[model samples]
Target: MVIESLWFLIVGALMILMAIGRKFVERLPMTGAMVYLVVGFLLGPACAGLLTIDLQCDVALLRTLTEAGLIVSLFAIGMYLRIDLSNPLWRLTLRLAGPAMLITIGALFVAAYWGLGLAAGPALLLASVLAPTDPVLANELRVEEAGDDEPLRFALSSEGGLNDGAASPMVYIALALCGVHTLGSSNPWTFALAIAWGLASAAIIGWALGTGIVVLVTKLRTHYDHALGLEGFLALGLVALAYGATLIVDGYAFIAVFIAGVALRRQEMKATGEKPPNEVLESVERGQREEAAKDPELAHAYIAENMMGFSVEMERFVELGLMVIVGSVVSAHWQELLHWSVIWPVLFLFFVARPLGSSLSLVGSSMDRHQRALSGWLGLRGVSAFYYLLFSLEKAGSATVANLLPVIVAAIVLSVFLHGSSATILLDRYLSKR
Candidate 1:
């Protein structure tokens, strides 16, 4: 009872501090994730002993919480990108999310399988889990606002949004190698077909659901002024619908949620007939609420803005709580994480695997060497990796996760410090050069 109460008290205090000191915290050299992580470590048995997490026992609970965080953040990431569908700027995003991502996965798999002497199953799982850049923690480096599509920010932001979902099939492949599912039981044709369907269906379902909801809400509002004043609820409902529908068809929910956000934004932009720069200064401010709603274009923009705001707020809240949990997990397992097996892979990942994959994928693109280097370096890993870790634990059992947990935790810890600290400075310099 005392521990439970202490948990509430500590969480409450942290929330209050965050609410008040967010601006001040933003100015610090480190990020909010770093601060929350250290606080969580202090709360763990290694220090204050106020909180303890059993990775084996709490896998289900942690998976659900982390999954929810990813869903919300993925949706928000989708909405952040306001670029037109035909914009040539998307070439950078596609290269990063598509080829760059696959190359990173392949490179990490080789290092894990050969350098670390792990079995193929575990090696692949580790690679898949760590490959995607985290959308949740990369908030500092993503688009500043809806219309702000600076190439670097847009590419990283969209890549973060796209790759999490894109990486799911690889994770399933890894699980199959461990005999966790029917994929391993089936033939190669079956595996290939299933993966193809999962990818195709997620994109279709998410885009349909996203565009459908926007159209529905806009029509209702046009005739009856309905669906007003609760864009938050609407956003959550859309995420749930897209995610649930995708899972029903065995599609990737992360992709569905992200695509849903993108589709909805595209539809909203069409409704508003407004381009990026025009909407930058016009927010869903209180004074413009009624007038904005009366005009169809403004109405769509209004709801889109409100939904983006709600999603961003939810992403931040989830980040603090989840980072604390990650910190406690680290505190409990620091000993296991401090080994050569763990050290080499992390070094190889950041220095060798990621840079090689990113550089190779981006070759022949117009981005300068400096921009390309920053893109390679900024693959921030956070909640998305944990989601996969807990997910693999649930399916592949403790043996697989045991090998993976240490390396994943170490990578995330290093990323939180290394990428988080340098992203702002590097990005600022890059922009200045531009």
Candidate 2:
């Protein structure tokens, strides 16, 4: 059809413009996520005339794209993180991942229950789905390099990175509740197994597979220096291996991918076969720097960089595709905002739920007031939350969640504007003064 060709042209052109102008956007107040979102908004037909998605037909494909986006983003986030187990910052990350995430979940449950007047199943589902910040959208809020130790950025990124899997248990819980409410069929094992064995399997598989690859790559490059270039794509293999193995057992693949990334990154740090950088600097000859270039440790860094580049490119491609579709969906449902219940949830999610939950998690931490506030303020939700919604809808196999979908979409639209617009200006200004 003529419309399909025009649609492809517009989408392709938009991606091209984003590619060329990436530098410009990076330096400005808006982000690449924002560009895709805004363009989607433009392309979205308010009257549902131009591009109405047939959810029944396209759901599988759409879900795959979003899942891919999350997969790539999670790996990238894990790769960039410096996994110092001994560091207090790691303590902070754990605290945030555990207590902070729970606090957000509980708080949002209240908002959904009282604010939306939903029963247990949908209320808990909304809370669980929306509680965690999305890594795909929170990339700008995260660290890009290995050595950078900015506290808020690290905390937010780690929280986003871990919480996707962290929230999976709750997703199972919510689904169980949905079963109880809808089918009057109660099974405690679903939630119990998902929380317990699922997490354990992800950790085990991810650690085993990821560390295995890193060790193999290190051995190969150490024995055969001429083969360094061959290891560039090893991270992809690690991701696929760990994720596939985890999912095969019904373990959390999202968590597995992230853990694999961390495992591999940790191997890189330790694989140097030399002194730590600080120690190396003291006794090293300035002229020997060239000699050190061939070291296996340096090779690890190079391999990690190439792997990160591949993941980032993949993440961006999936993100652009999904957001364009999201923009169209939001555009078609723009009038859904006229409902008071919809507006209520949007306001609560951004202003009340995220900040309150985030603050609750930071209760005893040494972070000062300003740092604490930024941590609360920067819970940017995107892609994965929508995926959760679609997943719940499909799993329930009914229209009970139909009404809730629009409200969640409305909240996401608000998030796209609220978080996207503020991420750059607010973060830049705040970090600049620091």
Candidate 3:
């Protein structure tokens, strides 16, 4: 009961701060995620001792909420992506998403073996879990607005969206090899079947549900007299449905959410005559016109108009939840930081695995020197890595291995706060100039 009340208070405070200080918070280097982590640490058992969260006891609830947040985040990402998949940028995204991820994982595995001195199983597991970049955090960097349609920006956005799902398979494989039971039975065939079933189920459900939502929205526009507010509700409902369906099938909810997002975007485009919603298009046009309307003496309209504020809000909520959870989990395992077994592997993942994966992924791609360099440098580790790490650790239940969990979580918190905070400034100074 004390814990529940603390949870409520923490969440309430976070919401208030986010509402009142969003722009100010995001402007600071690593400010958004940093604030969340700080709050978590303060309220956590290690500091003020006002909150104690146990995922082992609260696993069912935590999983459900985290999965829901992830789905909603992915859906918003899909809704905002206005890129044409047939473009040259799409090819660049493939290179970045595919090879870069592989290289990072391979390098991390080697680092784990040599630098961390971990056995092959655990090393590979750590590398795979941390492989994907978090789009929600990455967007905090310098990038075009959702409707900008700039090839480079679109490539970055789409790569972030698609790569997380792509990395899911590697994570599952690593877990199986590491003897983690979260993916289902221990048999290799059972694991393979579970993956295949999960992927197929998510795709099928996402397509059917996404198509239906698009059709229903179209009919509402054609037949109704009242303003439906379809976009807001549709976005929320689609995420809920996608998450619910994946849970029903015991599949990876993150993969299901991403597939749902991709399907929803594709279906919405098909329904709207192969174009994005005119609302977003008109908003972009208005932004451009207003920009032109400004004189040297007149105040410039804040570029905030160009962004999807609603999506940004949802992402902030997810960030809050993730930070609190990280704090609770890490505080419980604070002793791990002193161990070489833990410290060395965590260092290798950040310094070795991620960089190697990103470089490999960009090879043979059409990106210029600056773009490739930025891509490699901007591989910010955030919520997704933390989420997978905790999930895998819970399944493993090895105190020796579990002791290493906090070190990785600490690394992610470090990356998200430091990397996310500095992204905009760095991008403006480097990539934008290029």
Candidate 4:
């Protein structure tokens, strides 16, 4: 009873503090994720002993929490990117999420196999898990608002959004190598086919549901004047629907959720005929509220904006809860982290693999050298990696989890400290220079 009470007290106090001090915190080099992680560490047995988590025993609960966090975050990431699909800016996303991602995976796989002496399956699994930049923790480096498609931020935001889903195929492939039970047959050719189907079908499912739902809602609100003012509920419902629908066909649910957000926002753009200026967006949204159901464009803008707002709120909450959980998990696994095998790969990932791969990938892009360097530096890994780790635990079993947990935890902590502290300061200077 006392422990439960302490949980409430700690959470309530932290929320109040974070709410009141958000702007002040934003000015510091540290992130909200860092603060939450510290608090969670303090709550762990190594400190105040108020919290404990047995990774092996609590795999299901952790998996559910992390999955929920990713679902909300990926949807928000898609909604936040208000750029048109044909904008040359998309090339940047592809560069980072595609070849750059693959290169990073390959680099890590080589390191894990040769340097760390892991078997082929485990090496690939580790590489695949850590491949994508995090959507949740790297919010400071993302596009601040819809329609603010600044090249660096847009590229980072879109890359984070797409790669989380994109990494799903590689993870499944690695699992197949590990002899894990997965969606289809376990052979290489069959796995390749499954990957192709999952990616293609998930994209279709997300697009159809995302685009279709908004059109239906807009029509109902327009002609019948029903189903209005529930944008938050609509956002949650859409993510759930897209996820379930994708999973039903054995497709990648993360991709479906992300593309759903992008499609929803695209529909809004179609309704408005362009990406409205921020001032225009605010005016239209205000007009929408004052005179409900009067303007179709206004409804579209309001729905998209409100849904994006709700998803962002959910994203922050997820970051706080998950960071704390990550901190606690680190507490439980500190010994494993001290091993030489864990430390070197993290250093290699940050110093050599990511930088080399991303920089090489961006060689022909529009970004200047400085921007490319920062982009490579800021591939923050967080909730997405944890989600995959927990997922592997459930599917691939406890032995895999034991082998992978320490390095994953080390990498996430290193990122939270390294990227979290540097992002705001570096971004401020980068923006000031620009």
Candidate 5:
């Protein structure tokens, strides 16, 4: 534990450096994730023998930590998102994210079952596990909340936001097929609960809670401000409560958290009692916008900004810790990555599966050749994939999952290195040039 604390201090310093000097860090091809991951590898028994973790033994703890990280990060993604869904581009996001994601899953399913010769259950698990793109790397990718967004960035960010939640149904379906859950022909009600109601319930509750909190805060601003300077911090409590409460009832907490962020902004607009409803909310945080005016609304906006700020800082740290832990988790098998089983699955998923689904989904849409290409190319997968696979592994405990772990880890490593390094460079090269 002392060794762990020391390592945290070292990584903590680096995180601070990365936070303040992102401009400097951005100039290098080396990403902060790469740095933290390397640190994790070195501290791990694979090298220095300072940190050791057994994946099979510690799966539950890892699952809880990773899931918590994914949830709050999802909330941050939702908080900053200011997409104009009425716009064709946002609707195009629905096409690219929803249908395109499913197509990717189907292609992967065939690859796993036919090419890799896995059983139906394992194949389904493999497909759904890798289906969602991540917004955890959003800041590095220059992913931002909705407002004056170009089609490509907006498409990727929005896709990352919704698809994380959308992928839950596929995971449940996979679980059912894996015989972990009780849903094969024998349980229709359970099927509806897992596939349909979970996601819908999260959305409704998220929307209601988000709207209700903002309205209540607006109504009792005097009581809120004087009694609690933490109206902003209150959001953290609310988000945590939202997540826990939703999950207790088996709702999709990820979607609920994200939707709550959006709902918060929407409620803010309505608290004024005259929203054009069509006009997008100001994307550059409300508190910062009203800082100069000192209006009655500033207090509310101020609290919201604090919430947003806290979420962002927390999300970054959580992502960093998870990557480090992941690096160490695979340390035991470090030298055995030469085989086809691991290589083939990752190779097909990244180069073949993702691109095929993404490109085909964008055909004849409003976007031009370049936007479609960039969107397809930037299907950056991360936390959401790991979260589902870990949860599934614990739930099913299939022997097939043992085979799946190395490939999943390898794919994520490949993605973090290639995609993280390229996020800024590619954006500048293609989008800037355009």
Candidate 6:
């Protein structure tokens, strides 16, 4: 009873600290990722005994929790993206997703061979696993105001959201070749089939949920009497539905969430006639026209004011989960620091593999030289990297790779601190100027 009570207290305290820390980090121009990471390290076994609660043997639980977090984070990312598919932005997303991912994988594979002396299979596996950026962290860097309307910013935001889902197949394939699991046969075609199935499952589930919500909401607005806050509840329900449905179908829930968001946004535009209300939707429009008022910033502020806060809460929950899970996982394996092999591979991943891949993938794209450079530099590893690492290790049945978990966790902590802290300042000086 005492132990259980202590556990509850610790969780409650961490929750309060996360809330305070999130608000504090936002005002300071540093990222919440950095603070959470530093906090994790401080609470880890190396310092205080906060996360000394051991769970290393609980691989199944770790994988399940991490998977759930990944799915939630992915869905939220998809829902938040409000870009139009018909625009040039979609093309740019493909360019970044395709070339950038390929480059990162290729470069890391080479690095593994020359730098780490790893076999081709493991090198490729690690490269593919670590290639994508975490949208959960990337969204924190987004312009806060609605209608900030910078094309480049939208492109980066959408790319970050979609790239991880796109990279899933490649990561799975790499793992299969490394003899990790028999999700599919070793043939290239079989691997492609697995990818197709994952994507198809997600797409079908997302479309069903998205379409169902929009139709239901339309009916509610047209025929039923509902409160103003019902829309927000419906939105949250949609997110939950998308998550649950995808899991049931054995699909990638992250992809489903994103697709669902895109679908809902499309429906919104359709319902609203793709324009801000001139008179019918807003009484303020009449007053504005009478006064000949034309303040774009104020218009944006009004829209943001009317938006729901549920998405923000979802983002916070995912961020907290990432930090705590990372803390617990790392603390459990604190003894691995003595291993040079683990350390070297992680270093190569951050400094060599990712940069080279990003550079190659981004070449000849619409993004300017500065944007490309900043994007490469800011491909900071976080929850997604850890998720893949944990997933692979759990399936690998070997303690050799299992020992590397702490190193990866430490790398994520370092990334959340170093890159997350520097993103805004560096962007202003380098990419923003260009």
Best by lDDT: 4
lDDT pick, better of 1 and 5 = 1
Ranking by lDDT: 4, 1, 2, 5, 3, 6
Taking the tens digit of each residue's C-alpha lDDT, what string does model 6 give over 1-434?
A: 97678768866887787667766766566776665655665667777766664444666676677666665555555544454567765676677667777877777677666776766666666777677777677754553432233545665666666777777777666666667665465677876676778789988888788767665545443345222234446656776788788777657667787778667655544544445323323556545631222232222222222222456566667777667667655665656644676676667666776666666666676677777666667776777777777667766654435443555666676677767777777766754455
Error at 265, model 2, angstroms: 0.7
Query: What CA root-mean-square deviation does each model show from the true structure?
Result: 1.7, 4.1, 6.5, 1.6, 3.7, 5.5
lDDT of 1 at 289: 81
Q: How many residue pairs in model 4 have overlapping backbones?
A: 0
lDDT per residue, candidate 4, 37-98, as tens digits?
88888888788877798888899999998998899999999998889898989999999999
lDDT of each: 0.87, 0.75, 0.63, 0.88, 0.74, 0.63
Stretches of candidate 3 above 4 Å error? 1-14, 150-152, 180-201, 224-227, 246-253, 267-311, 332-335, 338-343, 399-401
Alpha-carbon runs more than 4 Å astray in model 6: 1-24, 27-29, 53-56, 143-149, 226-237, 247-250, 273-308, 335-340, 403-407, 430-434
Candidate 4 segments exceeding 4 Å error:
275-278, 284-290
- Candidate 1, TM-score vs. the true structure? 0.96
Comparing 1 and 6 on TM-score, the stronger one: 1
Per the 3 Å backbone cut-off, how many clashing residue pairs does candidate 3 have? Answer: 9
Identify the runs in model 2 with alpha carbons over 4 angstroms from their true place: 1-5, 45-50, 180-190, 224-233, 273-297
Point out the higher-scoring one by TM-score: 3 or 6: 6
- Predict model 6's lDDT versus the native: 0.63
Q: Could you tell me which residue pairs clash in candidate 2?
A: none
Sorted on TM-score, highest at the top, how do the candidates line up? 4, 1, 5, 2, 6, 3
- Quote the RMSD, in angstroms, for model 2: 4.1
- True-vs-predicted CA distance for residue 245, candidate 4, Å: 0.4
